[model samples]
Target: MAISRITTVEVTSEHIGVKGEPNISYIYSRYYRAPELIFGATKYTTAIDIWFAGCVLVELLLGQPLFPGESGVDQLVEIIKEKCVEEDYEI
Candidate 1:
């Protein structure tokens, strides 16, 4: 299968929170979360959505999530692993 285009459907509720409020409870899906969100950044831009779009595109290309994590920590681990591999650094 091939992905010609990607569309942003309804934004997840995790991305919706009151400004200046502590965003410790809700979070985006682990597989598609942006790095900042993973790092507990409550103040972020729409770029997070763009990051999620990129992840979805990658999933479409690879036939699976590029980051298939089970939890927040697991998600960070997957990202770190990918970064280490890319930089040719030992983890």
Candidate 2:
């Protein structure tokens, strides 16, 4: 689960210690992080994993990352550009 971004995530099939809490760690790959994480959100949900999975699927299909930004800010910019083009928004 993406909750691994938290400092400690313990799972024993009986309990989950972490459940998408505020974790500002930069350990997670920037490419797959959800927009909320990029914006420094304190509270989030497992839906972030869905975003990560989608990014992985796209990378596998294209043989390259769909948003190959160099850093966190760059990653957000890449995502915004894609969204703009997708919604036909003027830049």
Candidate 3:
């Protein structure tokens, strides 16, 4: 079976090893990346996949990306805006 292009090495069953510092490179599309990744976090667990899954689910339900950001910083802003509205937090 062919795997989807959306899947990345970070989605494997192996545990994510702890790094001494943050990684300079980030993977995955901006719309689907977790907050930690956008902030340059390198040591992360597989739980980041849950965030990606949530984005996919939202897109599937809405027929469009929930966070169609133009850039990494814009992606973070979009995510924060949506979350603030969801939690009723002031932006």
TM-score, one value per model: 0.67, 0.68, 0.65
Name the lDDT value of residue 34 in candidate 2: 85
Question: Runs in model 3 with CA error above 4 Å?
Answer: 1-25, 86-91
What would the per-residue lDDT of candidate 1 be over residues 4-75, giving only the tens digit for each residue?
556444656665756555564245567888878887787656676588789887887887788888898898
lDDT of 1 at 83: 68
**Backbone clashes, each candidate:** 0, 0, 0
Model 2: per-residue Cα lDDT over 1-91, one tens digit each: 1322222223353332146655553425787778887888756567666787798777767667789899888998899888787557764
| Candidate 1 stretches greater than 4 Å from native | 2-27
Residue 30 Cα positional deviation in candidate 1, in Å, after optimal superposition: 0.9
Better of 1 and 3 by lDDT: 1
Per-residue lDDT over 1-91 for candidate 3, one digit per residue giving the tens place of the 0 to 100 score? 3323343335433333344533322555678888888887776556576887888877767767899999888988898897776557766
lDDT of each: 0.73, 0.68, 0.69
Kindly indicate the candidate among 1 and 3 with the higher TM-score: 1
Candidates sorted on lDDT, descending: 1, 3, 2
Q: With candidate 3 superimposed using the best TM-score fit, by how many Å does residue 6's alpha carbon deviate from the native?
A: 12
What is the Cα-based lDDT of residue 17 in candidate 3? 33
Quick one: RMSD of model 3? 5.8
